[model samples]
Target: MAGVVKTGILGLDAMLNGGIPEKNQIVLAGGPGAGKTLLSFEFLYRNAKQGNNSVMFVVEEEAEKVLENAKGAFSGLKDIDDLVKNGSLSVEGLSAVSNASESMRQSSYEFGNFISDIEAIIADKKATRVVIDSTAVLEILVKDPLMFRKSMLALVVDLRRLGVTSILTAEMSSLEKQSLSFRPEFFLFDGIIMLYLSGEEEKRMQSMEIIKMRGSKHSFVTTPYDISPAGFKVFAAEEITQE
Candidate 1:
């Protein structure tokens, strides 16, 4: 039997019936300014603090810049720097060395090599938890939707084989419950977590929902959450009464 990997976020753990199933690939989908990046960092930060060595791989930005920004944004997590220095956590950025468009058109060798680099990093760090900042840019990298799906499927397989529970952030255009746009990722991951924003201006409120979790009995209730300097504070016990 497989044990659960605690996210270390109490409310989130409750929603997952304890924690994400061991080695599950979770898609954390939301729109711009939805706090996706911050939440991803916190996942690593919290888990690392709990002794689950973790690594964060970023594609859209530099690792140093991301870490610096996170430090400023989350003032309450004062020990983030110490965790990194102690080698319990890693935040690194990835660059596409080859022209993804041309390279992927020929074969999937580039993508395979890409996963290899990630595998190497995980091994070097002995990381049990992983986070890929976001995979939305893969469309531009792969170009062909068919190959894109293949690449995502391949990624899913590789991450599972690596024996690490991972989160792949996704960009979404809609936050509404019934109007979410269909995408390949909706089917590729072992679990789907939807982060939402509603209302407008200062009146805006954030919420989360567990759309699906393959093997676990997860809550379908959409719960409210707040992003303080303390990181993500999910209110798993309280459901969003309405939009």
Candidate 2:
């Protein structure tokens, strides 16, 4: 069987037909407070629980803080503090880089360094699953779409080459008419998952739509999902539409 990586979200594997394809790059696009971080954390945290080495490459959230937040999200998460302290779960891009953009200029280095740091982590940890918390950081760092696309392509290529199945989270605009500037990422990655929060009449609902999954079969409908203390749980819309 081809090596496969599970996302750790309940019912997500079924939607993707069998988890994220081996050696592929997938994007988790959503707006702030849309459970992107929570979902990605569940993904990596579950892998660690399964004895599969994992790494979380966070550009937007601090490494230490991310883990701290994850504890509340996954009640069974073990030794995250020790794992981070012992270098099992490594943190990268602590400091911002130069001329990258307003968002990244504060970091000690540029996005390139962040990518390299992730590569090193995979080699060191033998990580099978990875999550780049927010690729949107690059959108702010590189103003030109062409340059942004090239840099993103390089990072995605490098991650896949390492045999790492990665989840890249991105922030989207709340408006249906106002789209994200980094829409180009859909082309740069292997799969695209879009999360949206909207109200139909009087009820507010959360929906997860799988836009594309190259080389694999995936559900075509917008599934309902919820973020809770246990992490993200995806359910068939028909079954949960009442909420």
Candidate 3:
């Protein structure tokens, strides 16, 4: 049996019947302002706090901007700077060389130098948890659907082979259209967690649901969640009712 890694988010682990299985590559899917980034950061933060080293690869946003946003969004999360300085948490932005250089950016084959850099970080940091914030940009990188599928599958397989629990964030336009057939990643990952933000103005609410989790039982009901100074607070026991 595979080991489980605690996400450390309040009320979330119980929903997973303990925690996500170790080395499982999961996709965090949601629209804008769905707290995807926050959840990913909190996952790494909590784990690193417990002495588990982690690495975060910022694909869309810069590393410094991510840290600043986290500070503002999760004010209660103190000592983030200290954690980074102490080497408990490492955050890096996608390398420009890997993205721009022809030699590093392969046209038809593989994920080139970008993936190589991530592997290097994992080994150097001895990281057990990894997060790739937003794979939407990656879609742009590959351009071709077939290539994207192949590249992503290879990436997922490589990450799991590294023996680290990984979260790869993806952007979705709507929660109503929940279909795995739309994207190749939905099938490649071992688990899928969907975050949602719906309703109008004042009535708008946030919720999360576990779409699928291989090798472990998980709650299927959509649970409401909040993004406050403390980070993501999931109400797993309370099922969300659309108003």
Candidate 4:
């Protein structure tokens, strides 16, 4: 059996038949307000609390904003600031690299440099878990779909080589129409977790499903979940009914 890295989200581990396979790259797919960021944050925060070092690469939002939002969203996870300050957790923004490479000048060079920097940080910190908030930013940088797929595959391979379990977030236009036919990342990733927001406006609800998980048996049911002050709470036994 492959080694596992506990997600720390309540009830999620049991659904995964234990936890995510060590060194596997999983994609957290969802639309806006689906709790992708919160879930990923909780994964890292929980791991850090267990004496594991983690690094979060913020691409869609500013690092400071991500940290601030995490504090409010996960009030039950104490000492978040201290954990970051003490180097047990690290949150970094990709804005600098994005801005510097904006002219499309030497795109490959800039991208390679950024990857090198990430690898260096992982090594320096001995981080066991990593999160890349929104791989959508890479779509803007890479332009060509085929090239983006190649780049993404390379990045995942690198993360695996570094021996760190990683979560890469991706935005979907609509959860109802999601299909793996055209998404190369879906094929490359070791697992895919899709988050959903059902109902209308005021009555909206959030849920998640394990679409695919390699090397392990996982619950395929759409499980109801909530983003509370403590972080992600997955109701593994309760299914989200379409009313």
Q: Residue 49: error of model 3 in Å?
A: 0.5
Would you give me the overall lDDT of model 4? 0.82
TM-score of each: 0.90, 0.82, 0.90, 0.90
Displacement of residue 133 (Cα, Å) in model 3 is 0.9
What's model 1's overall lDDT? 0.83
Candidate 2, run of 10 with poorest lDDT: 94-103
Q: Which stretches of candidate 2 lie over 4 Å from their true place?
A: 76-110, 175-182, 200-202, 237-243
Tens digits of per-residue lDDT for model 2, 139-207: 777678887888898898898788888889888877231354447667888899888877664486777
**Which is better, 2 or 3, measured by TM-score?**
3
Q: Which ten residues in a row have the lowest lDDT in candidate 1?
A: 95-104
TM-score of model 3 relative to the true fold? 0.90
lDDT scores in order: 0.83, 0.73, 0.82, 0.82
Q: Write the per-residue lDDT of candidate 1 for residues 1-243, one digit (tens) a residue.
A: 898888877588888888889999999999888888988888899999999899998877778899998999899889998999999989977543234334545556466676777788888889989999878766567768888889888888999999999999998888765677658657988899988888888989899888888888778888888988887788887443332
Backbone clashes in model 2, listed as residue pairs: 95-107, 95-108, 96-107, 96-108, 96-109, 97-107, 97-109
Error of 1 at 155 (Å): 0.8
